[model samples]
Target: MTSPHDALFQWTFSQREHALGLLKAALPRPVVAAVRWSTLRIEKGSFVDRALRSRHSDLVLSARMGAGRIYFYVIVEHQRDVEALMVFRMGLYMMRLWERITRDRPRLTELPPIMPVLIHHSDTGWTAARAFQDIVAARGPERAALLPHIPCFELLLVDVSAGRAGDVVEEALTALGKVVLWCLSVSGDDARLEREIGHVAAALDEVLRAPSGLAALEALLRYLLATHERLSVQKIGGILEKAVGPQAQEAIVTELDEIERRGRAQGRVQGRVQGRAQTLLEVLTARFGSVPAEVSARILAADEATLVTCTTRVLTAPTPQEVLGDDGPRVSPARRPPARKRARRT
Candidate 1:
């Protein structure tokens, strides 16, 4: 089953206009207005594949709003959690894209500039670039360097747990953020949250009703619900009611329930597998004083057949040594080695 987070990630990039709107809302006014946004399709054989294997970016935007000006490129990468290698990955993508453009257009004057954007939802502090020198300095020498200064990408992080919904949206988007805050604040018991949910749901419904927005809205809802596990059907229904209307709430509820059911099923399967692995470890530890780290890891990684065999051995072994084979010392043998004695200090 596809996770909600995965669905949101997909939704963010699936529609060019939706992605453009998000960028316009998040970035500075001058930059947003100056760019005419559109999606960029990266084929399998393209240079983008050298750096990234994925078919689509979280969002790929092109800016062409300026008159008689070269259109710039922006690639937005969204991540639900913190990724340690994010900077390195972005660097690779930047490098590959730059190389491709340069190859296609030999003249430096002919190449258009590109920008990378990273959108993350994590509490931990993260930076898009590790070293300032990578952005400022050229690879070999100061004067003869091919590319001296590549504009470092921007990092837009949303920490859902840190603040109120209004604050979060405000920090990201002044107007729409308020809408998000209103939708999130609607409480089940409190009539205010319920009303707010209805309002937001109506707006969302209007957007989704449009042929272009339908797919995008579906993707966004899936992502939001998946990422925010605490979100309930009532809360979602409220939002849908406001965005899409009361009539669409039923369909939304059904979809949310289906998603929840799938998530629970996946969690249960994982729990069972982990439980069995832990049980096997405990049984081994009880039979043997301490199992070797490598052996224990192997046991944990073992299939059902291996686990059953080891479990049987654990129950039937007469002594700890028998359970662990020759690697372990005999516990009850009469010919056991004498305990080493410490020498008296002079």
Candidate 2:
């Protein structure tokens, strides 16, 4: 199944306004100024072939600017958690896209620029490798000597879960765009999401009246429904009505019917268990930089009660090992985040 986070991101960022705003906000100002904004367009292609989503050619998700001999691609990838091997993955993706671009223009000699962007939202900020060489296994001081041969390019990261993303979008995006981003930053975690609903409701209200507002609202509602389990549908409806005026119910009826039916049909115990295991692994990986093979095996084989305990501890645990150990990590860290740096005297 396509993840709800990916679905919401693909839908919201596909719009012209949000897509343009995202590229502007994430890319270097020099790069942004060089582009011809009027020619910008999201590439629409088939996803069946799975070779860079087949149709997108340049990326699984992408937009292009410039044209003919001058054109380049801006690739967008979204995530709810940090992936340890993302740098390696992006390197391969960029190459695949480059290969496709080469085939398209047989006379092409110089490769066009392709900037791969990663937009991730989680309670913890991004902590994975942004450059391919960072994840390369190198031992001793000789590793530094090997750097000259290793390919290196950093992926731009738009960490929407942090306060700075808010700053970027606040000035550049439309109301609907802001609502989509706000949802992305908080949707998966129930407590944080509940606390922030009112803040989003205000922007969401504005979105409801804008052109194609109902469609945007439907996407938001779908995200919330898929992500939240404790938040009752009745309460959400009431909030929408009070925040968005009387038309809210009528506007969302089609989405509501579809979502409700899907939810009922998918209330299977086996699926729920698998989901818990996957979510736990994602959380562990995001929290601790990476998970060990044994730790992953334990999690996969864990019972429902063990999963619940580990899930609760993941929020505060300093390391993945502590989740399965008697000595808990939920209380204290063995080392500070910037452990390599010495404290400076005042």
Candidate 3:
């Protein structure tokens, strides 16, 4: 299953208005007031470590400030638990960004300063270090002395659990940011998600006013389906119809139905296959220390019936061979009609 938190965060902040609003909300009031919001330009790709990219999604936005430019690297961390290595990871990403710029722009004399912002929305809240030096092993005077040599960076923390996200959205002057924040804040709770459907609808209405209105609507519909279990095709379509006019609703709902149909079908198939595979593997592991390649391949490739049979046999069978033996129950033959009946009628 696609993680709801990850999906929502990526979809929301990908939009320019929402990202701009996020920056304003997360940054210091003095820093936020200094910049021209209109000049905010999103940097296309991320420089985060590939291994950790699956859990942490990032976006880099840069803006013109007089003769100089400033870069904002927004790192969205979706994991529920505290990540001890987060500060180190952030530092690495910053270095990678600088490396890429240096390599790409060889003649440029100066690299724009990068400000790293960390947004987390875990239920348990953040308990990890906010600075790179905090996580390091060195301490006392030695640590203080080494600080000058070491790259020390502080993360601007936005803990969504503390209600900053909701406040940001409500306070934002734009519709896109409000909608994006609305989706992110209520993603974890089914009851809240359902209750706030009207608000989401209103936000969608606002989003649909832009030139790329239809495209935006489609994105929102997809995000809702991917993140929420309670939103069926029919429920979402109905909600859209009410929030956005019937014309917009018709366009979005058709796509939503097809996407949901495929998603649910695939989910069911994957769930069954994984459940059976795990059960078989567990049983084999319990009886035999290891499962040979051929045995594992057969078990994994087997149909539902074959898995059930093997699962039953594993409990009583003395050897792995017996559990997966060739000599087993054969499928029943198709029944044949009485031979004499046709001849008698003729």
Candidate 4:
């Protein structure tokens, strides 16, 4: 119950197939080749401290390699700001895990290897410290000479931001896995998610067609509902109907209706609307920095209906004025970035 983001991240990757797919994609080629995937099993642990809990979550999985076991410590960062001290964070997580291992095996001689991997996504690409050495305070040739003496570890980063999503090769991922990664990649941008809805819908159809899809779909829909403040249920329903058929749409819409009913009965509709106004302003600021005072006032004064209209145009609307323009909140054609021509995966 940490958040929708954590809920989805844990539920999806806990399954062996999804976890393995991501492991193969993110791990070193040699590590992939050596891992006895048949022996792979998830380890129960949480190394993310209380302060980091809101923005970060970790998954620990162990697999047999040669005569011993190796750990894959996967950390997913879902918040807006990048952690500048990510290297130290990774080291701390590894240390905590190792502590548990030592406690369990009191007579252990050699420590087991733990490879730290990060799955980070945000509005913009990563520009933080990538290596442990990057965060060191000392500099110059003298620092370089002492580098070998300092305990250092490099984190394997699988940055899945909007700008870097294309770098991910989806050929090996399952239908659900593909869609989860897809959702994570575009989680920060309503405009990007809008342009990519067709792709998502097609992928989601595959997930819903299965007999056991409802539970998984519920998790997915919940995540989208919580994250995308501007994305309307009607539009989501329409996309579902077209891609997966009406039955799927109806199932989801029914759940949504119940949520609205509860909100209305509890008289929390105004509070929800106010929260949406704040979220919308945050989105605008994250994308285009320092929202104008007039724009802030307009958002604060707007009702739920007015906000919905503005949400649709907020992505493509060039200026803050266009977001709440006199013309109205409607989908204006956005100049899409040219798609990267990827070599077809064999």
- CA RMSD for every model? 11.9, 18.1, 14.9, 19.6
lDDT of 1 by residue, 144-170 (tens): 444444444544333332232221323
What does the lDDT read for residue 293 in candidate 1?
79
Best by TM-score: 4
Ranking by TM-score: 4, 2, 3, 1
Please write out the lDDT profile of model 4 over residues 189-234, one tens digit for every residue: 7677767767767667777776767777778767887788777766
Which 10 residues in a row give candidate 1 its minimum summed lDDT?
A: 160-169
lDDT of 3 by residue, 14-40 (tens): 777778777887777767877778889
lDDT of 2 by residue, 1-346 (tens): 5556657777877677777777777677777777777666766542222643411222243434455423333433344557788667667766766777788788987887777776667667678888888888997899989999999888787777846474363656677777777777876677766566676576776777676876787788877877776777765655566555555556655556766777776767557777899999998888787788978999998877888888988887667888875574443465546557677999
Q: How many pairs collide in each candidate, listed in order?
A: 19, 0, 0, 0
Candidate 2 minimal-lDDT segment of 10 residues = 52-61
Question: After superposition, which runs of candidate 4 have C-alpha atoms over 4 Å from their true positions?
Answer: 243-346
Q: Cα miss at 95, model 1 (Å)? A: 1.4
